[model samples]
Target: MEPLDSPAPRPLAHIPAIPIFDPLEFDRSLPSSQYTLIKTDDLRSMYREIGRVQAYLHNLINRGDDTPSLAIDDSKRAKTAAIERVPPEILSMIFEQAVPPQTDDENPRETHRLAEILLPGQICRLWREAAITTPSLWSSIYLKFSFPKNSVEKMVDIVTTCIARAKGYPLSICLWNQSDTELTQYRPIIAVLLAHSHQWDNVFIKCGGGPRKNPYEELQGAKGCLSMLRRLKVEYDEIEEGGSFDTFLISPKLRIVDLRNYGVQPWHEIGQFPLLPWRQLQQITFVGYIEDALELLRMSPILRVFKVSVVGHSVELYHVHHAFLLELSVESLVDGAASDLFGAFTLPALSSLSYAGEEFPRDAITSFVQRSNIEQSLHTFSLTLHERRDTLLIPSSNIIKCLESMPCLSQLSLHDLSKRYTDTGPFHSGDISSICERLEPRPILPKLKRFSITGPPQMSCVYLALMVKSRWRRAAGGLVWIESVEINHSRPCAHAKSSMTQIPAHIESRESGRALALLRLYRSEGLRVVGSLVDEDECIECIDEQGYGAFDPDEN
Candidate 1:
């Protein structure tokens, strides 16, 4: 790597530093109401005092002991030696926990908290020795390449010293690929870090490169050494060849891998490896897909979560053979029987399921509900229909039915009810209310704490009212509402308004007994009713004017 040109240092001013309020007093008294008023003033003064003390110390350390201007202060020296008594290994562990995350706005290599960690060391010679000996504290380095001409080589040299001092504990380095020119200039340093890939446990590398038409070919260079690494992420300028990331198949220790905007490459060659060593693999996402990605998935036994999508092609899961949990996303489920995705065998441990596609078979939805242990542990269940197909195999009717089947759901998110409006017949809110009312008298979703329905405002309001009445009768807990716009306008805006106005009327004084009983149950069961509206300008204005702005959907 090329050496960075150094700049002239600025002159320092002479000033006596002061100590602010005691940390003990501030921590003890700050939380009271009476003390809150002057909290801001106290904070400002504390900041100024800290800055002054830091500046004074910087000036003192820069000048020699013989300088008359710098006086020796030994009051903090006793405390420093006492702190120094702690072992270097222990000090290193403490520093690792105290280090803050690196960001672009400040000196990336400098740990602003380092001085505080070494404050005990600053007080005496013994503490100083211990603090400097804690090599792990300096090993975690961040190189900011924004001003390459100013900071590159200096940061590298400092980092190298830290690594040498660290002995052998792996180094955690964060390098921000700021410019292509910097990348070319610092290629050797980048190669050094990449060549020692096994040492990297957490790393984020955002570099420049266009998506290759054949994604597997993109992993040709130093990227091979990254196979022993635990976490790997590759992002290219364009995402044409998502398949090329198949080169990542070499990573046997990988736990989390994110390949953005790339197509899934065939793993025919890589698949030949003994057993896919992704025992710790929990999450995997692919933005684009080729037909053979499923074959590779079958080879990976520990995968708990997956997301795969292809624009025009259909994704078929011939068998849901995974022994653990599974999550899938597809463009369309048209014509294909949903059961085909899951073999006769059901997901025994499946806890969360979300599907977004054109349409799903009602039998498949029923089979999914019937085959799984819906009565006890199904935590999250959501299905979204993208387009109006032959007919919704699972309509709002089926959804209400399926929900009735799941008794253990604590949080539920339902979306895309517009699919119920087909060319043959129109679905209505009454049908939804009737279905909800029919739900067995048991405390279905009794543990339900947070609920969200994103669709037309009318449908959401009706569902909310019906759900409240049902929950009130069963004594459910914590109701939170999140409403978002529907993709298609199946119902008119005027109709949505009329339905929302019916909400307050539904809780009328005539049925005040039920309403009061519901309120009482909510209080007793710790239920909170939170409601919101989306796509209704009038609702937002009313909320702001009426002082219920907290529920305004615009905030989301």
Candidate 2:
């Protein structure tokens, strides 16, 4: 009368023979006499009975099934339920975040492309459907075309699939081709991208080819096709010369442009250069001659940020003014060229200026500061000298005079390459001590808050402490407090003595201890002192204007 799945009533006689061992009691070691006693035949019979019972129970539970069907069903239902709980809109947003953060013209790694975008679709049917339906997830297509012919076809197919799935969304595309011999094979991929130029929001392309082989020739027809394009970055083999970027001139919405030439060929003449929509651009970075950069700046009236590496002498520009330019960065390989370029610009709203080269033209910098009348407005100034010869060090007087001109300056960074490997001359502790002593009495840079020095480790901690103390001393009754001081040793001090030399080591150790103690005292009063040995590569270049004035010690 009972259901087949229900357990049968236990026999009263067998209850006494059943195991009654308590788990806790069994855990302790027991004498052999205390063990349960059973004959071999009895144990075999018990095992047979247990096996029969298990089979019966299994048959009852899985009445019409065998291969874990119920478990599989339950798993499917759980997964479906969880997925159904998340609406498609929210899932799409999640997929967007899973994709790597969009970078301006940064080449996406192959691993990132697979794990973030492609792997999600392969997870399950539901995930595949979600990913396929989300246009934004597939909008960024990064293609590399250095593969063999067969692999190139496969890559093209993959790119086609991505474009199809993008579903009319604005796309961010990056194409890279490093093969020196496969120009014919990669041209098709370039063609495919140009076909969809109307949907491009950001596009970056870097390729190698001969001087006559322009990989971007297809772009000429796509001139009017770029309706939504915002950013464009192009880099080609320097040998590929004399190509015009006139197609980009029609991109009305373009705001940022970066063009890099990685070959030995010089930049095309200004007349042959791309005719960009200069007035509409907000930021421009050009690594070309001074004449070309000046010409571009002259045309870019509303440009906010400008960075250029001048390969030749500064060209004189008479009565040119940039009313809205906020930051200017110049890298002049020739000595005094940077200063000449600085004097050429009359940026009224400039707040930050960065200059780096073989020479730090103190007199030219002074003249530019006086001529531009930025002494009142300039807040951040950085100078780096890469001169290998130590014939002329940047005079402390020149630096002091510059600081005097920029009364509102808040951040100052100085990197002397000559001092990085050797401890001598103006870079020595005595000179630094004098400089700090001079700063103590001067009212220059009253609002100065952050000071950074990158060079050898020979800077006298005593002078550094004095400089910090003088700047932040409350007894002086100034509103500004020196918030951060960083001393980055780019190289090991050649003059450092080993502890095996007892007297010299002891003296050095004593001086170091005193310096650390002084720094700690300042730290207790709300100042930050950062001292560390850094690799030469970590040294921030003054010519790198990307975030020149944006260094914050608190963020570290």
Candidate 3:
């Protein structure tokens, strides 16, 4: 096997950086505000004075001072540093922006978000006061267990402190319950959070399944208290993806939901399912069959984004006409039922459509394009092609036709996940070549700006890069010249189930090298170009690893 090159550095890191007012003054955990008796003096001058002292001492220590007692004239120091001159309110805003994301950050690799806020508090009394006064600063709570286990007491304190600091403000919380710790131990932490159920605005709880009964059930008490709830995301241990909430079902302002429940077992049954305020929902992500998707569509008339993972077959076409939906994405977890959904949906307001299943429902989609004028309306389209036998799951013509139909499409991602090229045997190009060739023609997808393609082996990379190099110059004929290209090429498996990030060099050809250099040049010109050539079989994994973007329809 050819050795893989060094995995490239992060090209343009996106910090899921969405934020709001996050002041730290109000905390619910303490019996009362601990700093009430403490004077609220602006200590920025003191902070600067202290910083100078620490730096002097640090350098003195490096110079081998055993006991260097230093005296400084207080009158020699400036009253306030220039940075300290910035208003505390504005400083609060800066502090919030500087707080690392709860996840997707690797620099300091924070596991508990408590550190992001707590570290700033330790910086200076003035910054601490600024952070404390800003309630929004403490609202986005990430309650995750650190590996090797921090004491249960410590975890509980962190959770309570964050929630308490949020005061009466709505909370945006993410909880991770994946550990070997006994269920009883984690309950205290979640109990602290549940006590503030009235503040739950956006909650994401991911449970690593084991026990059927869980702290998530504690969420049941949040029903009437969930007035502030807007979004709730729950990934249950499929073994017990239980629900039938008493009050959560009736949240007045709840607008978004995302779930990873597979079976229609008890929770998914028509009557057994929780009776949520489906009418007010604006977005929903569900993983089930076409019939289940139809159920959500029936309930959420005003829904804008609907992403579904099709589980089983539903060939009996049931039509649905929805005018308010904007983005619809479908993938098959059971590998055949996805295409069935395309035949059922007719979305006129749809701006983005993505599909990854056994078949590409070409005729049905083409008809929708004609009926809804989606060719003009759609902006982002993604397709994931898999290997069935020696052939790709979706035909080349179907992909070409879909691209041809979407003239105004701006963002495009095509994944050629065919694994037939393994073992140096027959190398079926898996229609990746055809898609590349079809996209090179001008005026096809005239508005296309961003393109992403993932393929199996050497030939796919060579042809894809060549096609990109040609389309790079297509500025005429009313075509929007390509702006970004994200490529993921797979390496031959030398070890069973082998997986590791690889550098750019999969093929040593001069043509491939030139294309690679051109892509780098494009990035140097302030365009987005990222390539991930890896040993893993999963195409989506590479995209996720790049952290440049999610190859799927849009981020969840």
Candidate 4:
């Protein structure tokens, strides 16, 4: 059907016209039937002639379409095309980009979607050669040992081919076995990755986090062959009934170990867990009981970075002192429990400390600082206080004393990631006033250069202005310590749907008088300002070095 607004097609002036007898040319004395017969015969001959012309035009169009295609094929076949002249080395570099990147800390649980086709190799013969010859193209392999038989069969072939083509390059092996109760079915695929354990640079393995057969039992063959291993991450729902994941114990080059468990695997029962040469580890992330965390600290004497989640509590109490630990992050899965766990550890070499939980843990922090001998040495501190039904909003009165202890602090971030608390924020208005007074008249956190607050400050904007002015005033007088003041606030949202972000920032609005005044002050001082707000996801700064969230284990 023609569009409603479209014009009716008019005849082209240059095209042949249909032949017919004109009414004016008919003889007045002749019968109408006789005239019609003459006109019909003459029209038949004209139609036949037009058909011949139409056929010729169609033949020309077909020939015109094929000619350029034929020429392009010849040019490529004869190596006259620019693409055909590319050197093998350059082609290999281009092929690498077409391949997916290796797994990283950001996503260790990525899956086996690349099995059906190696994109670079499937394009053409030249591309296939370049991709096959480039060992790095096959180095990053994410495979699932469980499957639909046919696709698994194809994946097996692909893995075998990649292993051969990859040559001697180290492999980043990510294997996930989810629903295969009978492990023997994929023994061939398992054996293929296990054979290359000596060249393992980084490995991520995820198995049944619940009670099930031990997936790592097949990894026994790789025990002594992991000398070249550098990073290893293994996650399970819970430790199997009568099993231990000790296959990676012999790895010497292993500096980073990530053991993520979504289980109540108690400290007493964690003996069957992975036992590594802890002293050799420089960085570690563990999600377990606090007792197990302390044990790890005691074992890893030379450990530089340790991130821990206190998922379970310890029945007995003990203290661990590490002389070489530089960074310590404690994530309390239980409310009002963060500081209690900190009471059991001391790290004199600690430079950065981060704690996220329901309570502020001021007393624990003060004693911990004194016990660890970091009162004057700690340089960076981040705290996150989430409002809970069982917790109090007011931090301890000694909270002021905690900041005074950290004289060398360079960065301080306080995040009040509360969903239900609407009228208040991380500190009371009086606390904010007290803090500003300390910054102006008294001295606290003297070396603090970067101060960031997320959520409403629960104080008038006047206190914030005074605090900034005092710090910058000192800097101008040659004290020169203050750097940046980041103010992030959220307005009470109405008609917000459940699909909206957990915490919404009204970053789009700058209409408040206080906001305008602060912007003017910042501009008048000639400070570099970024007209951007930090992502809410980034406000969880206690997890990764600058962000928070649990590392989700495999759910597929």
The order by descending TM-score is 2, 4, 3, 1
Q: Pick out the ten consecutive residues of candidate 1 with the lowest summed lDDT.
A: 480-489
Query: For model 3, how does the per-residue alpha-carbon lDDT over 1-556 read when each residue is reduced to its tens digit?
Result: 2112213432222223223322334474334454633322334445556666666655654453354435455698768876667789997788767544433111221223666767767877787888888777788788655434457777778678777777886677887765553455566766787788878777777766555434456566566778777777776444333444445676887877876657535333543444578888888888755676787787788988887887767667578889899888878776456556666767888898888865566776777777776878999998875567645344465667767788888998987656432222122254465566556554578777898887655543444544555556436767766788887654542111232233343333323333344455445556576765323243333434544221113321
Backbone clashes in model 4, listed as residue pairs: 209-236, 209-237, 209-238, 540-548
Q: Whole-model lDDT for model 2 versus the true structure? A: 0.64
Candidate 4 Cα misplacement greater than 4 A, ranges:
1-137, 164-167, 209-212, 236-245, 269-271, 389-391, 395-398, 419-442, 456-465, 473-479, 485-528, 531-556
Question: Local error of candidate 4 at 266, Å?
Answer: 1.7
Q: If scored against the real structure, what TM-score would every candidate get?
A: 0.47, 0.66, 0.62, 0.65
How many residue pairs clash in model 2?
Answer: 0
Per-residue CA lDDT of model 1 for 457-477, tens digit only, reads 344232333455455443434
| Candidate 3 local Cα displacement, residue 447, angstroms | 3.0
lDDT of 3 at 31: 43
Clash numbers, per candidate: 9, 0, 18, 4
Q: So what's the TM-score on candidate 1?
A: 0.47
Whole-structure CA lDDT of model 3 = 0.62
